[model samples]
Target: MFSDLDEQLASTLRHRAGGDIDPTPIVTRARARGRRLALRRRGLIAGGVAAACVALTSVVLAIPGIRGTDDRVVPATALLLPQAQSGAPVRPGEVGADPATVHFSTDPLVSDAEYATWRSGRGIESVEFRGPSGGSRFALARTEVLLNELQQTLSSAGRPQPRSDVRVGDRPGVAWFDRSGDRQLWFVRWQPAAGLWAQLDTYATSRDEAAGTASRVRFDGAHRCVVPFRLGSLPPGGRLLECSVTFGRSAPGSFIEGALVVGDDSGRWLTVRAQVAPNGSEARRGDLVAGPYRARRQGSDVLEMVVMPCVVEAFRKGWGDGYTEAEGLAILGGYQPAADLDRPDTW
Candidate 1:
């Protein structure tokens, strides 16, 4: 009866047969085809369910603080420094690295030069790292200058209260918080070496962030010396004992003025100082020779120094009787061209 029957015929005969079908190869084949179609439909539905589960899993993983147990937000990229190790444990006195070499974990709020200039006028060499907002400013300064400033700050207001002993990395440090009127200041200081110290100051950031930033600071070496400018040649047996560079603007242009005090074993001292004006033209400040330097006698004992064009010349003369005029002249004559003494690194 089903010899020439198509799918429509098979369906009609199966329905007409009520509850039973004759035991034949054609009926058996038709039943098997129905089962295969049902399996295919179930497979498609299963595939769709599996795809939805995968998509939901992906979304859950992408949501913040949900996919895994770890709650900390891992930074995608870290700020890099030329001489810093990433994610290294830092300790006090472990590395007397220059503050300039310190790399914060976050992007800087200001340029390096601007940070340098900001501290130049304050009589200290410091590198500042700011948080994403205006209220977060952190600074690292040399130990000597930092300590001096701390002492001054404390003494100015009776006696400053100390927070507690703090450690950054392996370095032991101290902390202090000050609130005066409308301003609040927080400070953390640590020693990186026998004679070197590092400081972190925060204005508007949380203490934790400041501490974390301080701990993140690391250097690749034992120490890095970053000077504002390079020195030419010193007088014979003349050892540099003290120096300070100040950054400021002049009518002609930006200028840097500083004093370099040097002394020898003879108990003699020579003070060399010059204010460089960035006029890019010749300038004559006084009656000293005006080629690249001019010298004038302020008094019988003091010699005023000046520079011209773009040459680095020693301009000041405060010498004891032990060192002779010829020696001073020799010290000034060995003037290095402007290449050696560039603007302050911060400038």
Candidate 2:
């Protein structure tokens, strides 16, 4: 789900799409995804009807606390775990939070390092503390689909010390140097927990230094993977599935990349992807969310706009004729973080 898409699809939360992005493949596959999902949704509906028939014959007792799916007013943290709520401890298995809602904080490189620079991401779950002066440059992520592929970026150098096993603190780790670029990029991978893995792209010139940096990655804190924008309501029959944010490299607050997914009862998905624009002017692309144009992408109606440093969109995929342009705009208009696009700390 992570890519240089450096793109923000939920999966796009890893990296924002670049100039070289070829949308042909993704657009092609996405074109058929809706039909496949429609078939699956029908099956689910059929099953529900049978269950409903059974319930009709039973003497139902009143359940005082039963709740409906909609109108549950809660903060965006509705997607987060109790651990992220107030720095409280959660017993193992006590929480089953969505991967999109999970974010982790790492210990500082220096004892006196500030934690504010650590931004949320990797589905916007794992957090990495960025050093301004550049000391502790490490990242930790919860294990998911992207871990192995990311670690495998290193091509087989087939040269001196291509790959080696190392220890991160007490955990077993792998260290490798990617010689694909003009400079060598050191990488290390290890498990912070059973379902969680951590990665470190080290500047260290030696294997020992690389391992040392990775070993420093301690999953010390948790937070909601907060996106720069928010949704006041959801698409009809849709619920939030995931939301991810990516910060700029040169300046953490200078740019923001993000994605949010809302899935409906029909098994269709609505995605809102946001990223900074290449041009300095927002009007270069038009403020789409302001009065979003109902354009189409990959066979579905899409609402896209340019809000200055941010280019935002909400589009449909995976089954059914879903949200109309009006519906999509409601989701997009509710979030107006243009004032804080460069304020990562506020995120």
Candidate 3:
């Protein structure tokens, strides 16, 4: 029943897919080189995609998550550093506004330098303490929480929906969203074993009008901190899981059709083609599974490393560094690490 619909949808996407295909060979070769470069880099690092940052921030803020406190929250500078020689609390909000002053804890699980670099690029303006509900206390920027709130809202509105289990670098996560609409967005959150707070957001605005408006707000937003990740810390033999929903523009450009891809680091890949039936049912048409593909790493340092060529390519194409880790892991699907790889199971 769905085969006919699948073929129709595939035919509709043929042009876009074909254009996308033309770059595959070149991308494959570049990805091979990128992988080797990433391995040589030897530490998990984040990249900087200037354009994507703007889009991501806008989408995150627009969603319904948390509206950060404007005046009540205390900045990171106000908090006493664990090893500070002086007992005095630094003036609140002062240090946070200066990229140079914001520092990630020097714990082995966290990279101060990487955090600093991310803060410098993002221009973080303030840090706020959220909760100590029980024994857990989180120190996230007011903006970060705000973005999370936006994502939650979008998720609640059913604009962007969760699809499957996946990994961002070595961290486990889930993927969601529909493309081809005015607002196309996806997100993944990686909770590290080291007990640090971090998250990744990937969003796209295909409509020119929405893109223009979102771009303005995103660029003008106050918070600009980049979340940091430790890719090299992943267990050498760890596996990656990836699931994606691809959207295609409908005839006359009225709507988008989507498909699903589920793959794992164990070298298994599955593609489930889907379409919205006239009755509003999500019709699954065809399925394809293949695998045992090799994975690649890129970059010379943690500050520049790129894992997962496909994701890197997307970032380079304009997705931004923030999404690179998640995109790479998604591209790799099931990426099994070598025996030498070792990542801790618990934070």
Candidate 4:
């Protein structure tokens, strides 16, 4: 499935790069590939569920067999899954597996050839995504958001923020002290068709704490590393149909919130919350998943609608002082009205 998507992506990139390319063919290929992938994943999940059901049935039947053991001895173990012991108490931390430890960086400019060369030396695998606004300016808007957050954090901590330098991957980027007094470094590089950003931070705490934080950063980085672009240009007569939002706050006072909006024919718009996790995972609670709703025609336009209170609360907690009216509109896919959508002041 990934191979097929990669081919479609390559074809689309060719068209976007102006090599006498047409996108219709690529889009067709991608749609087909996506369908197949989804089906395959669903099948796997179904199979697992079915197996668990069968195992449960076997155990149930075995209970009757145990009563007749004097007449015909039957082993109870034969009727159960390997892990099912009738009298054993389950232990904590033995159910779900321990989370993996990993680290992630947040610099967005690691696409220069020089930076790529450096990363290759460091045994890191990197991939690039091409965007519409030329390679240099692609995702600049999202990067600006990150930069703003970094600046705010630095100022709050009374740390010196340096002028961001464009450097090759091999060279160490900028350095700054974080809110917790950790030293942070950043690097940038360019790739053939995309750019790269790399960041490294070292805390004064123990290795275990640092590793845990790094794991969180890695998860957060994975989510934040992607370039944000409109899925498609807004179609004529398109109207906003629905909006979903989410917000979450970590124990450490970090927070994140996000929203997704859908229009009748305007594709989708996404607004991401700004709290960075060490592992680059999606915000735990402030995630909104919407859609599968019917669109309605409003004159020449189409519309859909969704209202989720839990998701909005997550955003409220995460946005804190940084939230603004304009940002709220973007978060709600440009449809949420000032009066209809609840705000903190109103609450």
Candidate 5:
């Protein structure tokens, strides 16, 4: 009996000393419990934020500028901190306004898809004026773009003709013409400001016409509106990287399509667009419903939300970015039209 007691006591001491304890399972269980606690904490925080948004939205909707029609409740995004920074206001001779009402090619020279790809690569801003045959292309550029025009022309397959220093009104600039197949390409590069320049291009056109068109470009930088929508509750660590907003032109002027883009630190993006659809076309393609909004998942990473003429799209980086289906709905629910739809937008 004494020997049996000694054996039992020795076993107890070994057990107490953790000699037989399997630490791997204990560590794993502890880790799992910690993860659960963390998830619960995050859920509570999100819930609190959602409640606050609801309370704030009530007060925001009452504001006169943000009031919406009966069918559309104003979006709740107007009350958030601004993510867009103001830039220099549009001055005279900006790319949008031109003194001469010159006609451009009616045919599209570059497809929208092609332009989007090229523009993204160049990191430049431009406007595409589409016509029946071909459209004109205008861009705001730096002086280096002007200086390198000759080299860029030579690099192309087109045979470059004589290059000349020309004057557009009071400003001196460079002009060059190139022959490619049956088309004659005219390019006029001129300075609109001390450090800023503008490039105008046309096919089968004249240097004078291009220069005249370039002179009339006007930009008004004042009066940009904020994106009225934000993520109702942002994904963890989400932050704004870049944003662009444009307002559609009112009637009596050519229909100007508008767009908004918001990029985040998560390598994701949100885009909003307002454009005319052909009569008798369907607007809502999304079957998923977020309140009154219709939303749909496009492919694996994109969430598309349709609001009548305007379509908003959100992109995800990866699963860890936390932009789940529920989060996507919350973002769509946060959208509201800007109070000043007629005002100039930050692009």
Candidate 6:
């Protein structure tokens, strides 16, 4: 209890001094923040302008045939069969007028099996046969011109398949055994005629059964290869490889209808095929593959498709650069088959 309040007065003065502090540092920091924000906003606007220019350029370049002069690759139709690209194109036919025809069978080549479907290529034809066991290829040919080619291709040449010399009746032949998982596949090739050869293949069956099936192939028919649709000319230096269709009196819902395979001098191949819509096979729906195909299938090299009630798919079979989807569709435009595609009478 001192008479005068000196300590209290000193405390009060200290508080008043602290309350009246300098505001210069805070003001300076706020000014610096404002400048930074303004710079950032300007950068954002410039970046957006640059991005817009790039997008505009890309959109201009994306049009199909907008390249400089003849730099674009448009779908061109021409007929050049096993000839040089520089050669003059031949006259376009109302249909695939390929002179090369394979020997064909009107009846089932295998006696016990039923003839289901068939396909003909440049110089060859193969028929599909089905029975209680499964399906197989039992092909009979009338001419010998394509026998050597058949032997070479079916034999697989350099990287060869294991084979054995077999005799179907008095006709000497060879057999190839392909092992896939738990099943064994058999292909027996025999000289049915003096100059010509025939093939009998089993999907999966005993070797004895395969040999017996091979001996039963009937070789008495003169059927010619006639195309269903008008061919839209081939690519330069392209040759027809195979033409396919589904045929059967019993099976109402055929698997596939029309296909055309074109090959270049370099051995690259392209296939365009139109198939039945609502096919029972899950494999045949989206991508139309080129194979012996009665079951599951994977896609070819490059595939593109469209739905026209009948599904159409085309693919070039190699990793290298090749034709575009537009080009493939143009090629397929030549393959619209007749309504009675499954009937031999119409074929």
Best by lDDT: 2
lDDT of each residue in 174-271, candidate 5, tens digit only: 88877645666677777766756667666646777767766665433322223434444444564333233321111111112233343455565544
RMSD, every candidate, angstroms = 34.2, 18.0, 22.0, 23.2, 23.1, 31.8
Scored against the true structure, residue 136 in model 2 reaches a CA lDDT of 34
lDDT of each: 0.39, 0.45, 0.26, 0.25, 0.41, 0.43
Lowest lDDT sum, 10 consecutive residues, model 4, at: 113-122
Off by over 4 Å in 6: 1-117, 139-166, 174-187, 203-212, 224-228, 247-251, 279-309, 318-321, 333-335, 339-344
Candidate 6 local distance difference test against the native: 0.43
lDDT of 6 by residue, 1-347 (tens): 01012223333544664533223222222322332343345446654211100000111112222121113221100000011112222211211234233243323233333224445655456655543345566554445455444432111112326778887877888887765445666888887666455777675466666677677654442333433443455667766767654422111222324566777777666766554333222334443322312111223344434333344546554222366554454455455445443332343
The full ranking of all candidates by lDDT, starting with the best, is 2, 6, 5, 1, 3, 4
User: Which residue pairs come into collision in candidate 6?
Assistant: none
For residue 344, model 4's alpha carbon misses the true position, in angstroms, by 27
Q: lDDT tens string, model 1, 150-216? A: 3222111223466778777788887776653354556777765555566766542445555665676
lDDT of 3 by residue, 1-347 (tens): 22223333434454565433223222322322333343334322433111111011111211112211111222222111122222333332332333323333312111111111122212222121111110111122324443354213121234555566655445554545444245464444433333222333334332232222222211111322221112232224332121111111111111111112233345433332211222111222112211233223223111111221112111211112222344444433343222211111110
lDDT of 4 by residue, 1-347 (tens): 23224334654666574643334234433433343344346446665211101111122222322221112223322221121222332222221111111112222322211101000101122222111211111111112223233212111244434544333223423434334334332222122112233333333233333323222222122111111112232234433232211111111110112222223333332222211122211233222222221122112211212332112211212112233333333333433322322222111
What is the number of residue pairs that collide in model 2? 14
Backbone steric clashes in candidate 5, count: 21
Report the candidate with higher TM-score, 5 versus 6.
6
Task: Give candidate 5's whole-model lDDT.
Answer: 0.41
Q: How many residue pairs clash in each candidate?
A: 9, 14, 26, 39, 21, 0
In order of TM-score, best first, we have 2, 6, 5, 1, 4, 3
